[model samples]
Target: MNITINTTVLPHLDPDESVAFYRDSLGFEVRSDVGSGTMRWIVVGPAAQPETSVLLAPPAADPGVTDEERRVIREMMAKGTYGWLLLAADDLDDTFQAVSAAGAEVVQEPTEQPYGARDCAFRDPAGNMIRIQERR
Candidate 1:
């Protein structure tokens, strides 16, 4: 089996806000933007890694998803328990500062973990928890 990790879906209630957060705030490049209205899907990634990208997805926009499911997704997103994205950083402090300064909700400051990583966490505009770990 030839399997490659290409993209991960991160649910968003608003695509524009999520796009701004990932692109302008986190410094990720906008790889693609498709669809329109509430059904938009945006792909973003680090400039250095073009193959791997994160899909800023809108769950409520899917026609197959029921209203009940959309409600649940909204609740989860509001509670900051819906989406997650983990990334690697070259400098954790600088990354944290830049993201925080851009108005992201800071979950944690840059700190050395017992697991041997220096990392930080933040909640994007769509309530997704984005963790950045400094390359060791």
Candidate 2:
């Protein structure tokens, strides 16, 4: 048996901004884009890895989410605590410089973590934490 992650979902407050961030800042390609305005759902992934993708969807669109829960989610997202992604690159410094130059909100400059990995972090347009580590 084999298993792999095909897609992951992240909530977005604005579709266009999210698309720009993932496409321009992180250098991911927009695989698919549907709907319009706040109701949009976008699929994006690395240009080289067509099998893996991230889905940017509207928050609180599920019928199962209560109003109170939606409010809490919005608050957490605004605080940059709700959603996160862990990525990797061959050249950490170059990736960091490119992302930072593209105007991403830097949470941490590339540093050698005590955990024995070199990594950096940023916040996406919707405030999702994006941590990129050096690929071993």
Candidate 3:
């Protein structure tokens, strides 16, 4: 069996800001955008990897979630503990420089990890942690 990731969902408080972060800062191509305002759902992916994409959706849009759960989600998102994405780059330093220059909130500078990987991190507009590792 052949399996591959099609899309991953990330909750967004503000749709426009999330779109800007993934499209402008991360350089992902916007495949589609629907809805409007905070109700927007966006699909984005690296131009080279057309098969994989990320979906940015409103955090409390799920009908199954209670009001209290939504409140907790908002609190977690504000604390930068709710959503995250892990990506990789061929050139870690160059990627770091470009993202930093694009005004992404820097969480950590590129550093060689004790586990033998070099990576850096940043926070998206809604406080989702985005960690980029050097492609091995």
Candidate 4:
């Protein structure tokens, strides 16, 4: 059996802001944005990994998702331990500016990793750590 993890659902404090970061900073192609009353179900993927995508989701408000799950997610965000959302970009400097201009809080300035990745770290509006990386 060939199995692949194509999509991951991530907690977003504000879907719009997270979407903007992905779309503008890293130049991700937006698959959907209804702009209606519901929480925006935004999905983005590596330009090369067309079949694999990540979903920006709000704490599940559906009746199906139990309160315990919601509490766990909220607690995770509150503790600032949800880990980093890593993104790959063509230009590390430009992408850093793009995210900065969009008003993301910089956690770490762009720097070259020992392994040769030029990377910067920022926080999503929802307080998720996002790292933009470019290979040297």
Per-candidate TM vs. native? Answer: 0.89, 0.97, 0.96, 0.71
lDDT by residue (tens digit), candidate 4, 5-100 = 788766776777777777775567777664444467778766778897778776675779888987887778765567457777778888788778
- For residues 1-136, write the lDDT of model 3, one tens digit per residue: 9999999988988888888999999999999999987899999999999999999999989799999999999999987899989999999999999999999999999999999999999999888899999999
The TM-score leader among the candidates is 2
* Overall lDDT per candidate, in order of appearance: 0.87, 0.95, 0.94, 0.74
Q: Sort all candidates by lDDT, best to worst.
A: 2, 3, 1, 4
- Please identify which of the two predictions, 1 or 3, would achieve the higher lDDT against the true structure: 3
> Residue-pair clashes per candidate, as listed?
0, 0, 0, 0
Cα lDDT of candidate 2 equals 0.95
lDDT (Cα, tens digit) per residue for candidate 1, span 72-119: 888888777888888888888888888999988999999888988889
- Clashing residue pairs, candidate 3? none
Model 1 pairs in collision: none
Q: Is candidate 1 or candidate 4 better by lDDT?
A: 1
Q: List the residue pairs that clash in candidate 2.
A: none
Off by over 4 Å in 4: 1-5, 33-38, 46-49, 62-69, 113-118
How many backbone overlaps does candidate 4 show?
A: 0
Candidate 3 is scored at a TM of 0.96
User: Quick one: RMSD of model 4?
Assistant: 3.3
Locate the minimum summed-lDDT window of 10 residues in model 4. Answer: 32-41
Worst 10 residues of 2 by lDDT: 31-40
